[model samples]
Target chain A: MNHRVLLLALLLLALPSWAVIETYQFDTDLQRQRYNAFIEELRCPKCQNQNLSGSDSAISQDLRRQLHAMIMAGKSDIEITQYMVDRYGDFILYRPRFNAATAVLWLLPVGLLLGGLAIWALMASRRTRRVPIQPLDDHDRAALDSLLSDEEKPSERSGGNS
Target chain B: MSRIKLFLPLIIFLVLVAIFFGVQRRVQTGDYSPTALPSALLNKPFPEFSLPTLQGESLSRAELPKQWLLVNVWATWCPTCHYEHPFLVELAERGVPILGVDYKDRREPALKWLAEKGDPYFATVFDEQGTLGLDLGVTGAPETYLVDAEGIVRFRYQGALDQKVWDEQFAPMLSSLEEASP
Candidate 1:
């Protein structure tokens, strides 16, 4: 009996997750899918963090109703999104449209990656490069001769040690 | 080049500091609020609506006068509405045309509220179902919209209206709007 009560309590806890229960009849499965997708993507204006599907705020519920009615009336996705944008501004959209303001947001990561790649290529190319061999210069040769003369040849030194 | 590279981090940190301080200043001054959305209907015509007045009379676009006015969204349930009531009353006394939208409010409580606190609105829109409020893109009660003489939505403010807000934000805009009109 305790186990059953606990199970029932757990089931009741799950009930709140399915907030705002309103039956929306769609002509086809695709239409229903579109409705789900739209609710997920559309932000609740009142509850800024929650989407239409997650929020039970008055505005969110109303928007869900409107979305369902629009779908039932066979409005295209663009038309429906545009309708939302017209009323709630771009803030309603979870993914903001590409515009002058949002261009920086979308392009910054890609730009940074390309910049990093260019620097990496430059560093890699630098690391792989070998200084072109120069024939011994007169000054270098003179210095080299002085240093060598100061020490016995390795062959002679090794032979003496043996 | 290496010396300049050394300062790159400092430069980036300075830029970040500048950006943060700029945002902080705006937030401190009450100029920036995350929840307040810029109205999509700015510079657009006021949305058309046919609804009943508090007096049981029909009101529509035809009834809106060809004069600049304020549309205030309020409800008896909203605490801020009570806070701003006196200021609205003052504005109305100063000959500012004010229209009230009783958003998602019961008729009895709303009527009682008006009776207890003097009604400042020239005409009160009975939006019990929140149809007009939804059309106006009202996120919550105590939102106000400034409509120009041409029926254009000039501005939408999301908060309780006060004297400071009036002088600092709305008054300058109102004067400019008045000057622009023939």
Candidate 2:
């Protein structure tokens, strides 16, 4: 048990060194945060699914280096994003721009949810509005009294015999 | 009204299904290849840069011909460039002036390749560091740009250029630009 615990500890200790080390330097914490956010926002062109920070492809590495250079040179986020978009098209952005081509993609989900809710509410209201019980009429009251009397006379005769 | 309401979701679903198949069919038969990325530099002036030719001559945008030209990005390491090289040689021989941007390649091997295969470019600009290539929005080698007389970029095609690609993508654009030219 002790050996197993030591082995696990050693493995955990070696894990950090095995990870890929990023060499980018930021002057301030805010700059570093912005860099992280920017990379997370941008998709890696070569990898398709991974973001720039997560991709280990050569193009992604080059882009990261370029991003660092631009950030150090005081380029704004918009300028950096625009630079990438110009080269790679709008596909590089995780948050696509609102345009005619992508308007349906952005609006469809909300429209679907609203439509579903409307249908659900309509169904619920229809279910609640069941036909009300009508008041007993004079004819219905007379028929009910006669039925009760007939049942009571049979029971009375049986009770007297008992 | 309720009947229509009940069928509303089905109607939306059918419409979505139609759109999906339509897009799928369009993609399967589309003219644009998946690897071909649309350049934002279209209709804009070519990025300015001064580069040294492989032959030790300094070349710049001002030195380019005041007529239509093709700027082809190629490298020694790109295999597709080899396939497109002979076509370029043919175009060059037929009096088409092509400016070759040797992208991210060493000077010696590029010179050797040119010597062995015969040079197809009017002037081959050395972009060993790929700085000018980055400025021009070059994602990879074998990307070609068609520039008009005013140094304006008219069309960009990414991938190996051949007779079919030239006929389909570049030739039409070139003729239209020529027609529009005074």
Candidate 3:
């Protein structure tokens, strides 16, 4: 047990030494969690489809440090996000704000779904409204019966001759 | 009415296609730099930071020139800054005061590069940690900001500065600022 504990401690110590660990001091666990979420929500401007937390680029690193400083300085979430947006535009945010430029992006899917439902409803209502064939009247029934009898009599006479 | 309705989506699609093609042509012709993110510091007061100059003297917003000046964010490691060096040298020789922000670069290499390439700046601030750069919203090197007499950022230009870019973008604003000053 003593040997196993020593080996485990050695492994843990060696693990951290080789890694480039980024440490940020937060006043509270809540603050640290907020910082993590904020960084994940921010897109790295220099990278392709990468959040600031995942990006190791120089700019992303600098931005992360700046964000840490701002959070430590007691800035609110709105203030921090606004500061980023003011510097990098709305492109920095993972969730883009609703604006004139992004209106179509937000509304197009809803519009398409409503349109499809409208078309489906129209087709269904038209199908229900279609007039089914009226039941045969008495006169038509009698005529159909006489026609059938006349055809049967000929067949019967042919059978007798055969 | 139903016929028109039936063609509405097709008409909308065609219009969208035309708009897309128009934008594509504009992009292909290099009318806009899509990768160049817009600077949000325009018309805002320059961020405050006191940094040491190459000669070990402190530099800050208070010491900035009262007249129009250019603050160029550059580094020795950035190749585009080297490409823009000659143009900056020319501008400096023509009496334009350019304050260089040596962004996240080593002091020795920065000094050596200036000595070799000819220093175009009135003074270069050494920003080794990039703290000042973060405050300035600088994501990359080779960005130039034109500060008005009052130290407000009037304009920002990203990428390498060439004669045409200077003539078209920077010059007009510089002249206007000069005219409005006195």
Best model number under TM-score? 1
CA lDDT, every prediction? 0.90, 0.86, 0.88
Write one digit per residue (lDDT tens) for candidate 1, span A1-162.
999999999999999776647878888999999999999999999986889988878778889988998999989999999988888888888998988867887899999999999999999888778565679888888887667756967665554422
Question: Candidate 3 at A88: error in angstroms?
Answer: 2.9
Off by over 4 Å in 2: A1-22, A99-105, A111-162, B1-30
Better of 2 and 3 by TM-score: 2
Regions more than 4 Å wrong, model 1: A1-20, A115-162, B1-4
Candidate 2's displacement at residue A127, Å, is 7.5
B32-150 per-residue lDDT for model 2 (tens digits): 45556677688889988899999999999899999999999999999999999999999999888899999989999999999999899999999988877777778778899999999
Query: By the TM-score metric, which is better: model 1 or model 3?
Result: 1
Score candidate 3 by TM-score against the native.
0.73
Rank candidates by DockQ, best first: 1, 3, 2
Ranking by lDDT: 1, 3, 2
Relative to the true structure, candidate 3 has a C-alpha RMSD (angstroms) of 8.2
> For residues B1-182, could you state the per-residue lDDT of candidate 1 as single tens digits?
99999999999999999999999998888878777888989999999999998988989977899999999999999999999999999999999999999999998999999999999999999998888887888889899999999999999999999998899889998999989995
TM-score of each candidate? 0.82, 0.75, 0.73
- Per-residue error at A108 for model 3, in Å? 6.2
Worst 10 residues of 2 chain A by lDDT: A153-162
